[model samples]
Target: MTPIRHNGSGSGSDNDHVLDAVRDCVLAVGVRRTTLADVARRAGVSRMTLYRRWPDLRSLVGDLMTREWIDVATRAMAEPAPGTATRTRIVDGLVAGVGAFRAHPLFRKIVDVDPELLLPYVLDRRGASQEALLALLADALREGHADGSVRPGHTERQARVLLLTVQSFALSLRTMTDEDDPELDSAALLGELRTLLERTLTP
Candidate 1:
């Protein structure tokens, strides 16, 4: 069990392999059954190699999900369509974010395979990924404010609220008990999200 003091070196590909192994293992045998030994075996690395970075299963999975979603969120926020208004850009960013969560393999596997492993992250304070999302949204909100498309309010606060709201519904859309007359399908919900963002941020 040799511990590598520096984690930022060749650890890059090794870490990716470990997380990829984690993703595959979760998708196959589920989170409860997955283990460092299993991930190491699947990753073709030693258990100590993983221990050098993540001490346990939960932290490994956290890193895996954070990696998966951060890439998706980056894509959704970075590339705004031509001629999109600032408000509309935020709307599309949020909506794209929801779509990213729904479509992500790790996300679906967690909900379908072992949801209990996900509850802690949802019920508690924001994790690294969630906080990162809030920051990204906050930056977008600030941009919108500069363009006079966003309403006068605390940018960071509004971004946090929006991130929490979107993550709450996005993560649990399948099981959330809404009292609205007729349930809104995913498409309709995105449409409503668009409308809500438009109204909330517009002058």
Candidate 2:
């Protein structure tokens, strides 16, 4: 296939399309195998255009992963169903967020083949993505506390700890054997988390 041509325009809609195209390619081919050429072909843009937006495959994949995580966090924190308990909502949202990480094949494969791929972003605990997620979780928790839904004292510290705890659960899921029932464990763990948070924040 001929390489795609570059359009050189950095419009918001254009960037969204590029990101969307990259997402599809990563999902289809996995991150390691998905080349700039592949993304261009799927996006219908020139390889030059993709390169213009993201100079290398690593940068493109990184951005794609970041965008995906942000989306997951947003969806997980969205309003829970009517009549749902606030504690349940928080636990379910966290469970869903962790599930997304465990299920994303591209991320799973990368971490499996080269565990260090996640080191700087997750294990390192100080990466930009981690910081962003921490802030997001803190904001979510603070809002809940303000509304009398979440537990109260030391919102910042507690939110950071909660996010780290969630990360630990996600990492453990990746190592679990096939015989281990992830669904059951996820439910039990989430229940425990909710109970802990309730006790910590209860008025």
Candidate 3:
């Protein structure tokens, strides 16, 4: 991610403060209703200060989503059980990431309030966050190959397919969920996802 700038200097904490303000604004009124002025006010910074970093609300919100999503993915990838095989680690991390993203407030707001914002990333092109995630998945797959756990293949290709499968689960699982039917509920479907990944990656 590009470093966020403020007052002729760049700082991570400063960037987070700005994104936090953006998050609050979007959560309250959503993307269409949110304004740079409101974000500036909430961030306790001048509007020009925000403009220097982000020309418009869309770019700012894009960066905020990148940060939030990457954080979720990072946390998910970090928590596999001790001594887990590389393929198991990758599958577990991805499954956990699907759940985390589904539960994230910012993701929920965007899906509920401005779902079209996601259409470009889904149909047209990969966004920064998606690229980051692909890189992470590819690296883990390389490790799986080294350990003889994942099937042998082009790492990037394998990672892309893995991401495609996980994205379906993350984005569309809710539509398939049956709350009243334990046999086809979210948790049960996720178990199926776990099994699918295990089979896909096994050497």
Best by lDDT: 3
Q: Which runs in model 2 stand beyond 4 Å of their true positions?
A: 1-9, 80-88, 112-115, 176-186
TM-score of each: 0.86, 0.74, 0.93
Report clashes for each candidate as comma-separated counts. Answer: 0, 4, 0
Question: Could you give candidate 3's per-residue lDDT for residues 6-25 as a string of tens digits?
Answer: 23344889989999999999
Question: Over the stretch 21-83, how does candidate 2's per-residue lDDT look in tens digits?
Answer: 877776665667778888888778999877777778777766666666667767776585666
lDDT of 1 by residue, 26-144 (tens): 88988888989999999998888778777678778777888888888888775555667677788877788788878887778878877776676667655777777778888888888
In terms of TM-score, the best-performing candidate is: 3
Best-first order by TM-score? 3, 1, 2
Model 3 global lDDT (CA atoms, 0 to 1)? 0.88
Model 3: CA > 4 A from native = 1-9, 79-82
Report the alpha-carbon TM-score of model 1 versus the true structure.
0.86
Q: What TM-score does candidate 2 get on C-alpha atoms? A: 0.74
Worst ten-residue run, lDDT, model 2?
Answer: 1-10
lDDT scores of the candidates, listed in order: 0.76, 0.67, 0.88
